[model samples]
Target: MGKPETVRLVSKEGFEFVIDYKAACVSNTIKNMLSSQGNFTETELGEIKFPEISTPILEKVCQYFYYKLRYTHCPDVIPEFKIEPDIALQLLMASNFLDT
Candidate 1:
C-alpha cells in the first residue's frame, strides 16, 4: 500500500486529530469507509467525532495512536495509564473508534 493522504478527523466531543488515511484505517469506521468505492470523495462523513471524550483523553488517544504507529511490532497488551474520568471516556471513545 502506498502512503495515504493526511486527513483531519474530529471526535464527537470536538477533539480533532490529523491522521493519514492508513493511520485512520485503524478505525473501523474509516476502514469501512475505505471499503466502499466513493469513500475518498466522501468528506463530511469521514471525520470522526466522538462527543463523550474530553480533550485530555483525546490527548492520550493521540499518544496511544502515536505509540502504536511507532511500534508496530510491540505486544498487544495495553499499557496502564492513569487518566481522569473524562479522559477515560475519551479512551473508550477511541477504542470504540478503532474497534479495538
Candidate 2:
C-alpha cells in the first residue's frame, strides 16, 4: 500500500482504538471493520477510546501492533498472547461492561 490509508476499528465491547490507521489494520478485527461499515465514534484529531479492552490488554495489544508493524524489517515469529483463566473472567466482565 502507498503510505497506508486511514481506517477506523471498534471492538465488540465498544473500545475504539486510533492508532496509525494502517497500524490498526494489522488486527483482523480492524480488517473486518474496514470490510463492513461499522459504527464508530470519532472526535477531532482522530481521538478514539477503545473501552472494549482494558488499559492493560490495550497496552499489550499496542505493543504487539508495533512489533508486527516492524516485523517485516526484522522478521521473527513471536508467541501468541495468552491470559490466565481467572483474568479471562475479568475480560468477560469488561466485555459485558461495554455491552451494557
Candidate 3:
C-alpha cells in the first residue's frame, strides 16, 4: 500500500486542516509522530490530533509550515511570518511545543 501524500491535523475545537505531508513534517514533533518508529495509528492513518492547540493557532501553525518550507533555503528573500497580537502568546507556546 502507498503512503498518503497529505496529513490531517485536527485542532482542539474539532476543525481539521489537511496539508501536504512534506509541509506537515516542518514541525519536528509532527515529523517524529509520523515517523516509522512513531505511533502506528498516526503513521498509518496520516492524521494527528492536537488536543491542546486551538483552531486559530493550529491554522497559523499550518501556514507557518508551508511558509518555512518555501523560504528556508533562500535566507535573504524570506518574508516575515506574522502573528496576531492577541494570539502571539498562544502561538509562541504552540511553536515551542512543536519545536518548529
Stretches of candidate 2 off by over 4 Å are: 1-17, 37-50, 73-100
Poorest 10 consecutive residues by lDDT, candidate 2: 1-10
lDDT of 2 by residue, 58-79 (tens): 5445555666787657657765
Lowest-scoring 10 consecutive residues by lDDT in candidate 1?
Answer: 1-10
Local error of candidate 3 at 19, Å?
A: 0.5
Model 3 worst lDDT run, 10 consecutive residues: 1-10
Please list the C-alpha lDDT of all candidates, in the order they appear.
Answer: 0.61, 0.52, 0.90
Candidate 3, overall lDDT? 0.90
Q: Identify the candidate with maximal lDDT.
A: 3
For all predictions, the C-alpha RMSD in Å is: 4.9, 7.3, 2.2
Predicted candidate 3 versus true structure: per-residue lDDT over 1-100, tens digit per residue: 3359989999999998999999998999999888868458889899888999999999999999999889888758667888889999999999999989
Residue 43 displacement (Å), model 1: 4.8
The runs of at least 3 residues in candidate 3 whose Cα sits more than 4 Å from the true structure, single-residue gaps closed, are 1-3
- Sort the candidates on lDDT, descending order: 3, 1, 2
Q: TM-score: which candidate is best?
A: 3
The TM-score of predicted model 1 comes to: 0.57
